[model samples]
Target: MEVNLIVETLKFLVLGMSTVFMFLALMVVVLELQAKIIMKYFPPPKENSLVSNSTQELFQKGNFSVVAAIAASIRSYKKKSK
Candidate 1:
């Protein structure tokens, strides 16, 4: 009886573990398939150089206030960390 109980317990453990592993593997496969399908149907937008160029032009045309604010914020963050 003792031997039989241990054998049954090990069988149950293997079956439970295998079921969980299979479920997780299936979930990963399904998610990958969904991502591929979405990408195929609805692709991401391309980056526009014109937009970036305009932003650079604005910075080049005397936008030191924004730059100064960013530097001040970074300096304050560094001081807080120290």
Candidate 2:
């Protein structure tokens, strides 16, 4: 009876550890997939590109480049989340 109890406890401990590891691995995979999808759909464009050229002009005139600043912030936030 003593031997049986020890074996059963070991089995349960292994099962629980494996389940926890599987969940952690699944979460990592999901996060990677989400990042890939987002990057593919909403890629960051060049700083000198048309979208940013206008913002650049505004900056030269002493105006805050709100759009560029916001995009940079969002990109940094996502990167940090990973």
Candidate 3:
């Protein structure tokens, strides 16, 4: 009777361990699937900005005189602070 009890306890332990492992495996699969779906629809971010486009256009239009004047004004302001 003692031997039978030992055998039954061992069986229960094995079954419990297997159930835990199965649950962990299912969780991993679900996480991976969610990542794939999010990436497919949302995608990653980009670094492009409208300010950069406007700056490029300013350079192309020969507006350096305006830029120089603005820089000089900033320099004068800085000098006044000192």
Model 1's TM-score against the true structure: 0.51
Q: Write the per-residue lDDT of candidate 1 for residues 1-82, one digit (tens) a residue.
A: 3579888899999999999999999999999999999899998776543444343555686767766776798899999999
- Model 1 lDDT-worst window of ten: 48-57
Query: Which ranges in model 1 have alpha carbons more than 4 Å from their true place?
Result: 1-3, 53-82
| TM-score quality measure for candidate 3 | 0.55
Per-residue error (Å), model 2, residue 11: 0.6
Q: Estimate each model's TM-score.
A: 0.51, 0.46, 0.55
* Candidate No. with top TM-score: 3
lDDT of 1: 0.81
Tens digits of per-residue lDDT, candidate 3, 1-82, equal 3579888899999999999999999999999999999999988765433344353566676778766776798899999999
lDDT on C-alpha atoms for all candidate structures: 0.81, 0.82, 0.80
Q: Is 1 or 2 the stronger prediction by TM-score?
A: 1
- Using lDDT, give the best candidate's number: 2
Ranking by TM-score: 3, 1, 2
Question: Which of the predicted structures, 1 or 2, would earn the higher lDDT when compared with the native?
Answer: 2
The residue pairs found clashing in candidate 2 are none
- Report the Cα lDDT for residue 41, model 3: 98
